[model samples]
Target: MSANKTAMGDIASSTETYPFEKDERYRSQQGLNGFAVKEPFLPNGLGLQVRKRKMVRKRKNVDESPFSVLCAWVVEHQIGLSLNLLLLLSLTHFFFSRARPYTSLFLGMSYYNPKSKKYTQGWEDMYFVATWIIIITGLRVAVMDYILKPIARYGGVNKPKAQVRFAEQGWLFCYYSLFSPLGMYIIYQTKYWFNLREIWTDFPTHTMNGLLKWYYLVQFAFWLQQIFVVNIEEKRKDYWQMFSHHIFTSALMFSSYGYYQTKVGVVILAIMDVVDLLLPLAKMLKYMNFRTACDITFGVFIAVWFVARHVIYMMVCWSMFSEIPHVMKQGCYNSTTGQMISEDGGTAVWWNVMQPFDRPGGTICYNNNIRIAFTALLMALQVLTLIWFGMILRVAYGVLSGKGAEDSRSDDEGEDEEYEEIEYYDDKIKSFDGTNEIVTRTIALPIEEDVNAEEMNLGLRRKSTSPTTASAPRRSTRRTGSARATALSIPGHSDKKDILGRIGCDKPS
Candidate 1:
């Protein structure tokens, strides 16, 4: 026992004069105590020698130009800047009548009629649409960073990747929750609420109510903002799928509004938004490690997705095929008068279709080409949703197999850390008697803290460390001979598999 204690003391003392002693580069790479080698010299001859290659530390050059600094500041405070701009515009519009027309173009509803209490779709609506995109972007940032992050921390979501995912899901939950109900309300008031055929009855002359118009425009803005968002945020395995979904969705909204199909547009929006609410809820619960809650929410999400996207939404698409051709008259009409012109330069028979007498402009028409384009866009969106549903079914299978749900498409957080190779002797340690000794031993050594200690301090690191075991455990006494031995245990060494398991792999699919 005394010999073993002396051997350990010698090893500890010898580490003080290690070849790379006090070398920051070595310490940074090998950890705080540097590399340790233990060899006890016996009275007889027993020797061991090890060689280590020197490592060079590379420093990154950081750009400190004024332009770079300004750009960094702008990115960091984008939400604040957007809010300030919005405030400035609101104040200008409220205080000055001369600026009202100009600022109202961005801040207020366009082509509004006070007598009828309605809004008309026009090119000028694009100004408000752009402004709302900025507003939604700012609101998303504020809600995620300020509201959801703190909630996630409180709920024990400590990993930086998990926290980010939680915040995203929380923000989406809020948006979808609010808008889903609003969309349903708008649909409830429309004649098409009971009859799907009414969607195309009046065609391009459907009355644009205030609630429906604003809902449609704001929804479009949100989808447009999402395109910028998905590109800026971390890229996932479903990057292209999400990107394409946002593109098709935004284009569909724009086309619907342009063709005066707000009635069907609102219905599709309501159906789509309903399913979105549950998915984010499930993701947020998963991030917080609520296993049961997440599983239950995921099940609900699957049901809603089928009902809303596959059943109800498909019905709307079918209506476009069966009802539109029968109800809508395809011909050139005067936008100024909503009068369908005959080939003889006279007004055609005044059918049951409503005339857009409220709108005065150039001639507009809804032809077969426009109908085909619209149908194709809607089908494209459906196909994207179907692809996502297939992914969901895989998750469901995982759950059934008792693996728990996980998002297979999500990428792992951070890059993998490379591990140094561990060399082994010829299954024996030679003794002073010149005979091979089969020694069973276990040694515990303090591992150097991870380089990202600051991130760990901020709860950004993925591992769950107990308060009592905050730092690495102290070294254990060395043992040799006859007892069964275990391999060296190193804490805080994360490989690619571990990282993937920590972040998205463990999430409910």
Candidate 2:
């Protein structure tokens, strides 16, 4: 009895502090320490699954229902880009020449350029290429390996393939690329028989310039239309969102650009080349993890663009600035046979693309050193902006939509992250219960202290000096103590109880 009073005094005097575990019933309410969360002890007739069945919803607040315009822009961008890569590659052969010592080569034969005094060699066999191989082969693994594949499988990348009824049309991409630079060009001196300077750069050329300027304007206008709708509809997937998709397509285009430039890493970004070849088929087979596939595709796209650009810029200095002439020995008068060879200039795409511009002006600027085209410069600038703007817009949308982080749903859905189903158990799943008297919605959940849940559970099992048990037993123990004293004195108190006539249950007043 003395010990009990001492313990009680200690807990009471320490009023300055209340140990976090002050009650057991409250703990039980949350479910006994932690073996599992207590579902309400449900009676047979009631369960939650019957109550909260899944709901399907259509998107609301989407402002731009005119999807036709967006689709049209997408088609135009793709077609224009494909033509730029295919036409130029088919007509350009400067990269295959081994006479150019810096170029990568696996196999080829030599050809004498009488116009240029040196013997030029060709290297066309592609063997053991490194970076391009990784980009290509890694496509499958990126989509299927680790966590990414699971996430992708959760997405709708798995769908049925429709049969193709017709054969593909040929663009002569491979042939023109191999033969054009080899001096096998069938038309005028080079593939660009329509050089504006040859026809005078004043009227029609100026008109071409206006058309190109309009393409840029229309491209950005589509982006603006998409972003505006995203702002109102609170959707994460919008036209602004679609620009990020360009990372893949642009990478492919630039690889062809690198090939046109004849850089050492011509094949570096080629992973998607094969991806381009096989992704449609893979999607048809339902053999793709969509999230991982897009991610892999995006990563390789970005890497190849940056690395290929890096290699091209670094290699361009030597390949173009070196002073070896095609055939100076033939002399200027005799050299009037084929494309004009100037001894002072370097060889490569830097010359091929820009030579026309310089000849018209009768002056070339070497001040920039590498002689990079203003057009290529503009492209590099835009690519950087594209990446930067995409990231910025994501953060903007998240902040604007009040979703602190961006989550992807269907392309039609806004930027909200799809909520995953909360799992309880796998084998013989124990259903969730709201009325079982333990768990409830968070609005009704009682607040608790931050003690480690594991440590708290350990204390419950040991029961020795458990703070929860100590504080909770006061009333029950007091009732037990008083009951014992009353039983001991009951015989002596009988007269007192009879006088009051209220002590014994069998006695009636």
Winning candidate number (lDDT): 1
The estimated TM-scores of all candidates read 0.68, 0.25
Q: How displaced is residue 409 in candidate 2, in Å? A: 15
Where does candidate 1 have its weakest 10-residue lDDT segment?
480-489
lDDT of 1 by residue, 8-74 (tens): 2132222222232232233453332443233433332432221232222122345699987886676
| Cα lDDT tens digits for candidate 2, 254-338 | 3322222221112212211332333222222222223334334434533553443444433332333332122121111111122
**Model 1 Cα displacement at 347 (Å)?**
20
Best candidate, TM-score: 1
Which ranges of candidate 1 are over 4 A from the true structure? 1-72, 94-96, 343-360, 403-407, 411-509
Report the backbone clash tally of model 2: 17
Off by over 4 Å in 2: 1-61, 65-365, 369-509
